[model samples]
Target: MQSSISLPRPIPRTALAQAVLLLLYGASAHAQTPPTAETMLTPVTIRSGAEQENAITPVTGFVAKRALSATKTDTPLLETPQAISVVTRDQMEAQGVQTLRQATAYTAGAVSNYFDSRVDSFSARGGTVTQYQDGLLRIYGTYNTSRPDPYTLERVEFLRGPTSVLYGQGSVGGVLNLTSKRPQADTLREVQVQVGNNARKQIAADLTGALDQEGQWLYRLVAVGRDSGSQLDHVDDDRLVLMPSLTWKPNAATSLTLQALHQKDKSGSLIGFFPWQGTQLPSQYGQIPRNTFISEPGWDAYDTTNNSWGYLFSHQFNSDWTVRQNLRRTVSEVDYRTIYTSFTANAATGRPARPVFNSDNRTVYRDASWQINGGRMLLVDTQIEGKLHTSSGTEHTVLAGLDVQRNQTSQSSWRSVTAAFDVYNPVYGNFRPPTASQLMRQPNVEQRQWGLYAQDQIKWERWTATLGLRHDSAQTDTEGRPAAAIDDKAWSKRAGVTYQMDGGWAPYVGYSESFQPLGGVDVYGTPYKPQRGQQWEAGVKWQPPGQGISAYAALYQLREKNRKTTDPSNPLNSLQLGEVKVNGFEAEMQASLASRWDMTLAYALTDAKISRSNAGDQGQSVASVPKHTASAWLSHRFASEGRGGWVVGAGLRYTGSQWSGTSAISTPSATLADAMAAYDAGDWRVAFNVINLTDKVHITQCLARGDCFYGQARTYTLTSTYRF
Candidate 1:
């Protein structure tokens, strides 16, 4: 089933440049028309010190005062009445993080189950999280999307719990928003080179400043090139990224930022799906080496290319009202191929047993798969914000918005059983290629969704209240498969209240809802109802006045219904009669003490269970969710009369034992260590970092289905950066 609709082509550079010029010209013309009577009557307030902190701006230290993710407004974290975590660029640089998962390692309620280079797979509050860039959703389809490079982002934010009131149809866990680096008025130029273990080499540059004397136009360019090898043999990690942005501020009241991205990745899968016998449990042949390569060296590959163009526009009619519009289009393609171990029938029971290991415990059966996937997505959002005062002296901030999204995807795949290979002694080019008959053509899928939402924040005295509601309608069509088409409509709501107390303490409570549409029909020919989620959370935030510290502790309970489960009446079919519940507690604190020391502490406790299900597995623990996780990081800088200084840091991470979704198997807990040392001079800095300093051999997780994933090994890197 080939797709009849062709993919959209990239916009020409000349056309794009012309369009930008026209927009700037029009904006300038409008600015010259001068201020209206209404604008002249409105008062403008200047922000200084901490009041200048906003969602997209650079932070001075580890603690952030304001974030825009919770309410899509520049609201103080203490007043948002929700749990949010902000990972700043300073924090990422200090920790030497290279991936999204690594950047959030210290955040409460965040978890990563395995190590994979192909994608950044992580979860929060025991459920998968949706990814967003600059307030717009990043629609992904069947391994066709490219991973974001951390170097190109200003900050990463994690919002805990359901957020459907703002973002349409999404996971109940939360939303991970990546803020891109935008043009700035202040000039900045920097270049960095890095070398690390596993034959890694990299270079990166960031340049941003004003483009004209009037400071009306600003531009920024960021690029990275890297080549590295993984802990696994014969697998490489390579990437190229280029991001450029331009901002036009014809006047103080209106601004527009144009951004474009091009990224390409060449990497292979790191997971081998090794049997539990040799990796987790003891075997006659002893433990298998962690670097053993299971897939064919030359045939195994995961390559991707991504391109996107977007703009963020905002205008203020007056001090009391403002409007904003954001739009983006993204196209991605992926070529994936791999070989993994396959289970064989048990000799006596005739049931599928664990991956068949030879008597020597060195050979295993395998299967191969190849796929080509393409995806295109377009997103647009428009919103109006207003501030009003009631007759009773109460203040109100209201917001109303409409957002629409379109996604199209195509895939063709083939799979077949392949020859077995010995793990101890490798042999390649012996397996047969997949035949034409083994090819499978998947239906082209197209989905369109639109949402309308409104929110209000009322404030009187020392109390604040928040109320929100949203309605969403979605349609999904499968090419040549009308029977599978789906039409879904849903309503989401959110409400919260907070009371500001003396000494910088705010205790709040909030309730939020979410929904995700399901596509296929059940065995009875009835369409499955969309999965629904709701959460109740209460927390207290403390950020003492004039203190460079922020802290919060929260408790939440979330429930999700309509999950798919095996039908007891018909084993071959499935039913939507499953439910899950997670009760969790989280606490975190970040501080920059007296400009000499920086530290962060985090702890999380998650209790997740299958509350209801048609299958016999009711009451079972959820897979890949740990019961306890904690981390702490501390760094100190030694000042040397402003000429140069030395900094040193160390951190520890602990993951408690987790259930493998089965009563008979459980993954063990492990704790790892990380350390960094750096020296800063007038215009240059050098740093050395070591992750997993002890090189502990541990299993991240294992499945009852018969495989285990290995944790990352020790890694070392040296980086030198120069600023001009």
Candidate 2:
């Protein structure tokens, strides 16, 4: 517990010196230009056919037919009526994904049963998910941000339930947009190298095209460098990333794009909390060695540094009207330290105190923490889109928007009570590091939000209706902290309908609403209001047409209200009456099958609980949620007779039993396996991947307020790619 703050150099050096002076002014204007003929036919008519199928382009495999975060327009996910999932960029390079929870590991009501390699703790149908990029918002606070690098993503969208009409407040379980990989006018180059097994090593690159040639100046650069090691033991998983983008398009009705991001993360903390009696009810000093390294290896750390820059503008006031704007600015920093297990006190069941072995069953007791977080964010979004047609012929499609957000945060913390290791005979430096009078400086928080939205979809003939509305105003300030300056206002609504039957199905139904504002106060200080949610979904979608396949199924009932619980007659105060409910079902399928088979399938069942509470855990069940989750993947390419081929894949993941929060301890069920092989010749490609293949030792959740979380073992990688 020693951190006097001072952490701010994980490379951003002035945004890499303004990205090397904008890459030497776009390489001296394309090596002092010279081409013509409308710059040689403008990169073959600028991304043909509906601009290559809108919504952040790039999809040729793992089916994705338009999506702009469920109705931020660009529709079509079978006419969007909620429930959306798309993980594309060729399905995260054929499932060799590295984070973003492994590219939504077969998403379908998404959930990422904790195994934190420093954040990306996801959840969807059972609440908490917000994190948008390119569609604005990217977390505001908590463990200070920075985590986005699935090779700088090209897709990953999930928009399940309550989206607050169009992204305002958040988390009634949904929205996880992330689509970055801009600037492209054809040409692309790639280079990749990777090696696996905890000793991992990596390199990556992806460059995009036309800086001139009248493709209206496009450019892109993506880079990644990594050094890894995990599966516990003295943890480490490093990373450095840089992303650059530029686009100008000064013709076909105006456009702009400018993006930048720098990321750094030298990690540690692959989440360890141990206890739960040697992990999930086991004892006699057995268990707890899934590559154990319970913190304190040079004092555990989870470093982070992030920088961002943005722009995305569009204009086209003709052929139907359009206007768009998006902006971003982010700065983040974090340096967290950790140690684990520590408990005491159970004066006749006042709780906490269980796990005091040591008569040779191995010592325990520990505690430590040191955090220094920082954040800054600014986001703006402005929109207007239209496509009318009235005269009783229906066909609307309107959208209106205004969005703004600002956040500034700072925190410093420290805690202590260490020394007492030996989780089965082990030892470490005697321990001691909490000083500065045990610092705890928090109060430099600021948050501001603004939202105003409207939407319409209409259409007639095959019927499709969708309406939305939103209004939000929020504020939160604290400078020296006495906490008071929390203002919130909300209004959100959405309605949906769809019917486009005639072979490719489309039935849909929706109703959404969400709000969130609660900050703190109870014990009579009162000041916690805002946390309302509602959802009722119904879905069915199928995409037959040209048959690259797509399918969906959904059924839902979500609820939330004030939620805070535990003041049952002042047990240390906290009350909002609390309520939560989730009843769900989801199914998904994506296919490129038959043309060399590529498939995906997912299933979810969730039935989260706690419907109304005054602290007596009403109906429990909803911690790391999992009432069955399933996944499947299949791949096959095999062609080889010239341009080269041969690809193989296999996958499966399942999680069933849960509960360990409203704990009556229940954490069983697990299944994992994944494999992949690749080869291609005319552009060199090579791959081999594996995930939890058999070295499975489960336990991804545990917490009756005493540790446990581990899953993910048996990882492998080997990749080599080249393309020009």
Q: Which candidate is the best by lDDT?
A: 1
lDDT of 2 by residue, 1-724 (tens): 2222221223223323433444344334444444343332122233434345777778777888789998887888888887888888888888899888889888876878787866886887778888888788888878897678888888988887778778898878888889998877888799999999989899999999887776778888999999998888888888999899888765565566889889988887776577677777868868878787766888678889998887777655456766677777888888888887666544663435644544455677676788888888867777788889978898898999877676788888987756568876567777766665676887787777777899999989998999989888887878865757788888999999989898888989989999988776776777899899999899899998767898889889988988888876778988888888999899989998555888899999989998889866788876778888899999888873323588899889888878877545777888898888898786899989898788888997777766677888889899998998
What are the Cα lDDT values of the candidates?
0.84, 0.79
Q: Model 2, residue 295: displacement in angstroms?
A: 7.9
Q: What C-alpha lDDT, on a 0 to 100 scale, does residue 527 get in candidate 1?
A: 81
Q: TM-score, each model?
A: 0.94, 0.32
Q: Weakest 10 consecutive residues, lDDT, candidate 1?
A: 3-12
Write down the lDDT that model 1 would get. Answer: 0.84
Tens-digit lDDT string for candidate 1 (380-491): 7777899999998889999998887778998889876676688767788897666546668788899878888999999998889999999998888899988888999999
TM-score of 2: 0.32
Error of 2 at 396 (Å): 0.5
